[model samples]
Target: MKKKFSLLMLMAFAAAYPQDVKAPDMSSPKWLRNAAISPDGSQIAFSYQGDIFTVPANGGSALRLTIHEAYDSDPVWSRDSKMLAFSSTRYGNKDVFVISAGGGVAKRLTYHSAADVPTDFSPSGDKVIFSSSRLDDAASSVFPTPILSELYEVKLAGGMEKRIFSASAEMAVYNADGSMIFFHDRKGYEDPWRKHHTSSVTRDLWLFNTKDKNYYPVTESIYEERNPVFAGGNN
Candidate 1:
């Protein structure tokens, strides 16, 4: 069952990012997606072929981690670069999991039967933030949903998850001070014909302050903006 779901996820992803995915050059054979630099900026980790792998920042042989038959992707390195947090479908449902950066057994961190995708790690490396449908009261089933995906944070040692925002967003990056998180928001629709349909998909960047519990638009343009990260300085 877990293996089947993994295949399904890969199919969905392929449909979504097919144009963006480029065939690897012979010199570098791996087709990488969602590559993120470790907090220290020393190494980079990314998902490829349903697993997480890391390589040197300057370039080197990719080291594979988490070999489960189920899907594993969206790898985020801890602040110290000692552990990696990512989402996997190995437990028969999409949930967040963590593993040592060097390589080790992946431990499940979330138990939502619905999808859970880890987006970022806090600056302190004590917690992980992800998007999930688990908190929806009407979402008894995973696939069909009127409820939007919300942002949540969970302790690395494992504990109750905390809801931080109510919006369907993706590719979140934390502020250096951990006071705010930036993400791209989008709405989904059932109708396939409408040009501006929910599924038509327009995204924009947003910033949510953890302390004030408020969300602010970061971009005014209608064009889809995604994966915003703080370049330098403490915010």
Candidate 2:
């Protein structure tokens, strides 16, 4: 019987490849990073599973901010705690994007080909400070490297970005009045997250004065120092 033989073949194929597949467990998420608290200290934003999320600082249900398939990370809150600026790979490169604190459509800020990562928002919250390896000075002779990025700022209303500093300064956070910036300086190629290993390649803390364009060393310890943020009252 030809019909009987066809049914047997179909049964064998179904048994070989099952239709149901188990989904990944999300009960306990691990490897969440780039957590930052809002200026008002009401909620905390962070990156997990290639998306941004916010949870109450006092411990509560987490709110999903981004639901896109693209990779998004580094949620930096605005000074007023109404907006968030983050880096996403939706447009081929890591470009800066801003979204409301309550979650909504995101607005693209930077359109450069190089990766742009948001470091902090301006004191007035009209512009966002980011770091990118876009270009260097025409007179400089140093070789180009992606690890060495330059600081830049883009308007929140959307426009061309302006270069702030031409050097490798990562994870930079602004002071209260935007007069000074506390950031960690990179000397050479080294794993930023590699801890407890002390060597010459370790990163150091520095304070950059916006008025004088000068750099002041904050720490000279052999241990690695990264992600320096200004506390209350210029401390």
Candidate 3:
């Protein structure tokens, strides 16, 4: 009789919770991610579900920075710590955008058809660097989309974008005085589970001279060494 009662309870529990369903809290305030600290170290910016938020660096209630139906993430702060640059799909494609660090309406910066992910702020903090495949030479024969990427910069005050670097250079950042740049020469550097796998396609660190547009390898290992930035960061 005890065995029979236990079996009945098990069936009831199975019926209450289905295996294929996701929990309601999967996309809530508890799911904040992609956090970045401000240049002055006073605040932290993060993404929750599909919105962007800012909270005190010392820990406090998070303040929502973006409230929209589209997803916004990958936030980077400007040097003066007065503005934040992030990526958003609000315009149908992921593009560069900026908002007040204190919280306000976000302004779209990039309008390319391809994905434009914000990498970092310019050394002067007057512009933002983003990685994308907006070049004319990008491979399009692939069934879905091209994988090659390049870097570009757009003014924070809003203006035309300027091509910074050519294909295969991404997740790039500038030094304090904008005299040099640290970046990776790989397209799939963003893949989450690519660790311990070394090959000819592995991402390597490269330091670029902004003045003469010359570059040299910082790391030549087959292992991944992408997304190079300063200790405290250029911005």
Residue 50 displacement in candidate 3 (angstroms): 1.3
Give one digit per residue, the lDDT tens place, for model 2 in 1-235. 9999999999999999989888877877889899999999999999998999999999989999999899999999999999999999999989999999999999999999999999999998899999899897676565678888888999999988998877678999889888898888777777777868799978888888999988899999889888887777467
> Could you give candidate 3's per-residue lDDT for residues 99-132 as a string of tens digits?
9988888898888888999888987778899888
* Residue 84 CA displacement from its true place in model 1, Å: 0.8
For every model shown, the clashing-pair count is 1, 0, 0
- Tell me the tens digit of each residue's lDDT in model 1 across 1-235: 9999999999999898877667667776567786989878888998888889999998779899878788888888777889999988888878999999999888889986778889888888889999886554354243435345777889989988888766666778788888888888755543323354232356678888879978898875645566787886555
* Candidate 2 residue-wise lDDT at 150: 82
TM-score of each: 0.77, 0.86, 0.81
Highest-scoring model, lDDT: 2
How are the candidates ranked when ordered by lDDT, highest leading? Answer: 2, 3, 1
Which candidate order results from sorting by TM-score in descending order? 2, 3, 1
At residue 181, give the lDDT of candidate 3. 81
When 2 and 3 are scored with TM-score, the better candidate is: 2
Clashing pairs in 3: none
